[model samples]
Target: MTTLLTPDELEAALRTIGAERYHNLHPFHKALHGGRLTRGQIQAWALNRYYYQASIPAKDATLLARLPTPELRREWRRRLIDHDGTEPGTGGVARWLKLTEGLGLDTAYVQSLDGLLPGTRFAVDAYVHFVRDKSVLEAIASSLTELFSPTIISERVSGMLRNYSFITEETLAYFAPRLTQAPQDSAFALAYVKEHARTVEQQQAVINALKFKCGVLWSMLDELDYAYVAPGHIPPGSFRPQDDR
Candidate 1:
């Protein structure tokens, strides 16, 4: 039987998962931050990533409904508010549209998700389903990816601003609030996982949940890289960087 890990040990294990498998290590991100992609490639990225951003609240809502306590529900609901906002034309999703618009993508087109890559849709949907169906412990642990996000967000904001003149601070405003929000969210998730995952089976499940979440993120980039970078096999009907109309 697997041994149970101490809370500190489990936290360390989760961090190690982020270090090794997170999308920050993806070549697409390296190319993005290195300013190696064309404006159209960046446009495709913003357009595709918008789907992930837009789905966050729905995913959180699924988990929110499953929380057994008022405190847990209250804490989880903060994510919905952060992403969906107090009203429309605000919050993280709105800020993401601002990015797409700044990238010259039509807001309606991006929101319509008309040309989103098949892989992007599948990967993101899997996340929503995971939260909805997994044990609440696994569901919360999946969000532990946010623990590593602040660093990547900082890297992306600085790198994009410095390398891509077309990208302004306003264009990347989506990440600014996330700098604070992600840490707060991840801290809560990590603590919850550490507190609740007391047995060997539960601890391993928590670790696997983090790994699964990382795969979701990494696969999204894998599709982007395949379609836009090497081999350049963009699936039919998907947004084409060359067609930037």
Candidate 2:
């Protein structure tokens, strides 16, 4: 913690965090991607995930307002446009709605977030608040999860298509753009963190920020696994899969 890491060492450390802590390693992810989940379970996953997806613009906006330079703000601005789009039926959030629609959930119900798991709400809200409250370097570092996303997404789209009768290429169209978008976004974040995280303390902060982001993502899945997989404790007032009902 005292030695300043060279950029390579820091990048390696960040990648190590992704390898160790990312949610793609979760059992629920394994089951979902391996096609072991029932339709109802998938429904629960998609429904719960909608809140996180829809919140990306707001999260980006919080950081955007805080970015100190025109360049940084402009770069961050693209993320908002990517998620929110210039019009309805465009961008990542709308595409995510396509995913839920394909899964047969009512879009209104998904957007209402009334059935959102408390853990999901808390975890995602913490992420937004992290962006809003953290140092700019830490805020950007928190988005380092994007570095690990393409792999999980590939597994998900292919796995869901192969296993689920209802899942179609169009259902997961949201991820297709992300295959490119995530890398670009993460590349910028990684470079920015490496360039600016100069002190040992700052480097550690970046590492912790990524760990926190990973924890947020991991915790969301934990909520899903608990409600849908393990002791199957569907918390009160949360969405109930027909299986659980």
- Tell me each candidate's TM-score: 0.97, 0.98
Q: Which lDDT tens digits does candidate 2 get at residues 91-170?
A: 99999999989888888999999889999999999999999998999999999999999999999989889988888999
Lowest lDDT 10-residue stretch of candidate 2: 236-245
Note the clash tally of each candidate.
0, 0
Residue-wise lDDT of candidate 1 within 3-102, one digit each (tens)?
8789999999999999999999999999999888888889988999999999999999999999999999999999999998898789999999999999
How much lDDT does each candidate structure score?
0.93, 0.93
Report the CA-based lDDT of candidate 2 relative to the real structure: 0.93
As a TM-score, model 1 comes out at 0.97
